[model samples]
Target: MLHARIVRGAERATSYEVTLWALALVTLALDVVTTTYGLEVGLAEMNPFVNYLLPTLGLAGTFVVLKSFALLVGVAAWWTMPSKVRGVVPLGLALPWGIAAVSNTVLLAGIHL
Candidate 1:
């Protein structure tokens, strides 16, 4: 018989880490790609309606998708994960990934010319 150890304040941390990490990662990625690549889908021009509009829209859309996925994952993990391992696993995973993703996005966006 396997016993699960529940940690203090793990559930909320898991949820927050999942959601925020996704948000930060996606936001940064979208910003970087759009700012650098300027968004085109196989020759279809994705120019913004106004200056900087396209990047804004792109970032928003990316945020929505990533956040939705994160939320779903968090909920699933919360329910399915063993109490002992629930939050720690995700927090450990999300924190590093989140920082990397955020930094990548910022760097990419910064270099956009």
Candidate 2:
């Protein structure tokens, strides 16, 4: 019974981790899409770093580099952190990205209508 309970707990943890990772990926995608659309419509980039890169790397290149860096950081955190605290990595990434996506969508909606 004890062993079965441990397995169940581990499975639950794994599912939770997967859910958080999925949320992070979805939010990242939304953020990229909204930012790309906003830029095409003449909206300014609010992130100073990305804004600086805009001129040099252009749109697709900048997002590729930015997202690649984020992926690396997330992978590193997942490998180095303990299982109990692993959720933080994806949660941290998702929250800000989700917020940006929502705000961008709202601004774009306001502009179009």
Which candidate tops lDDT? 2
* Per-residue accuracy of model 1 over 3-36 as CA lDDT, tens digit each: 2224546655655655654654555455445444
- lDDT string, candidate 2, 9-73, tens digits: 65565558879789999999999999999988999898999989989999899999999899899
Which residue pairs show collisions in model 2?
none
Runs in model 1 deviating more than 4 A are 1-57, 105-113
Query: TM-score for all predictions?
Result: 0.38, 0.84
Alpha-carbon runs more than 4 Å astray in model 2: 1-15
Measured by TM-score, how close is model 1 to the native structure?
0.38
Point to the candidate with the largest TM-score: 2
Ten-residue stretch with the least lDDT total in model 1 = 38-47
